[model samples]
Target: MTTDALIPHATGRADDPQVRRRAARVAGIGYLAIFVLAIFANFVVRGSLVHPGDAVATAADVAASESLFRAGLAAFVVVFLVDVPIAWALYVLFRPAGRDRSLLAAWFRIVYTLMLGVAAVFMFLGLQLVTGGPGSGTMGPEAGMLMFEAFDYAWLVGLVAFGVHLVLLGRLITASGLAPTWLGWALVVAGVAYGLDTMAVTLLPDYAAIADVMLLVVALPSVVAELSFTAWLLVTGWRRPRVAAETA
Candidate 1:
């Protein structure tokens, strides 16, 4: 490109509008895919009730019947992996050029996504070991519980990291003059909920069930918010990153 074309404008750098539009479209679709996977995860975990009166022999039975749980979880991992690139694309679309990115905001997203993978790894391992197949009798009920506990532990830590990531991302959106304050706040709130819900399992051993129920409640709202935000982005694209002057 010529020097004149490469020159920075008042908005910092003149990026291609079409590129930004495409990135926004991709991000919107990625978010929708992740959300659907999350719903699938819920379906997988909601297994049939094994009443105390029933002659249930092993945890393997429970695992076997609810294999959808494993499948859903695996699907989640794949969708999340796909989400990373879409997220990066969105960040690139809106991020300021000609600015020092020594402390790049994308780092937070990468860290959060990495933690998600870690949590998934632990959970997948636990699922694999717990699911009764050929070598099911090797591990007792207590052992099965231990595997679950370990997975929960890893997930708890990951949630904390993930929450921090969301907070940082929300802050970045607010500061970047891209997207609405409402969407930014929603992102931060969802992230905080992720951490808080996991806190029950991490710190308060007795409150695990309560935490799960709380998560279910908060998740509905978050999913709705994300869907709404994605729809908005797909329809209108970003409406000129919110700026103080625009508000004024």
Candidate 2:
């Protein structure tokens, strides 16, 4: 009997472990690029300080807000467009073909990533409208508030899906022995943390900003773990593609 017929079709490719590992390494780089872009983009998206107590004062404030909002919108588009493809590519790398399960996972990742992009766009629009003061254009304060709410709702879904994907990925990585156990655990933990944070923010208004901060904390270790995994994958190239029995 052929080994191919005996083993389940996990990878979508022609069982080329080398190609998959290369894809994983490239996906890691894409993740790194995303991290860099997000961090750098923050500076441009900050917008002139909207003094707490003071009323909407000057045109410059409005101009700064508009500029920041537009930058945020543009970033959202880029992030979404880039992320969907990245997720699909990565999914292709790691999927275990059991009917359409792999396809479903890939689709969820794409949906969640796209949703996140939509959320970002909504937030940017809301911020821009609010910055325009009370009666700027068609949207008013109420509309801005609604936009924020929509953004938050959409983000909740994205985070949940993303968390699930990460947890599954961690399990896959561990089973494959592509990286250290600690790295696998880190992915699982980061995924859970983000998932929980998303839930918390949705239910508790007081913890909204706190949730965002928590995600950053979770991400720090997660990124480091990922970088380590990338290094190993690039260097070793999954030399011993761990057998199912071995993982067991």
> What's the number of clashes in each of the models?
1, 0
Cand. 1 Cα-lDDT: 0.59
lDDT of 2 by residue, 194-217 (tens): 687777776887784585677686
Q: Candidate 1: where are CA atoms >4 Å away? A: 1-14, 46-63, 97-104, 132-137, 209-213, 236-248
Error of 1 at 242 (Å): 17
Q: What is the C-alpha RMSD of each candidate to the true structure, in Å?
A: 7.3, 7.7
Off by over 4 Å in 2: 1-14, 42-62, 96-105, 131-142, 145-149, 208-217, 226-248
Question: Per-residue lDDT for 19-123 in model 1, tens only?
Answer: 565556666767778777756663445233122223233255556665666676677687659657655655655554422331344565666677667767655
Best by lDDT: 2
TM-score for predicted model 2 compared with the true structure: 0.69
lDDT score for residue 168 of model 2: 70
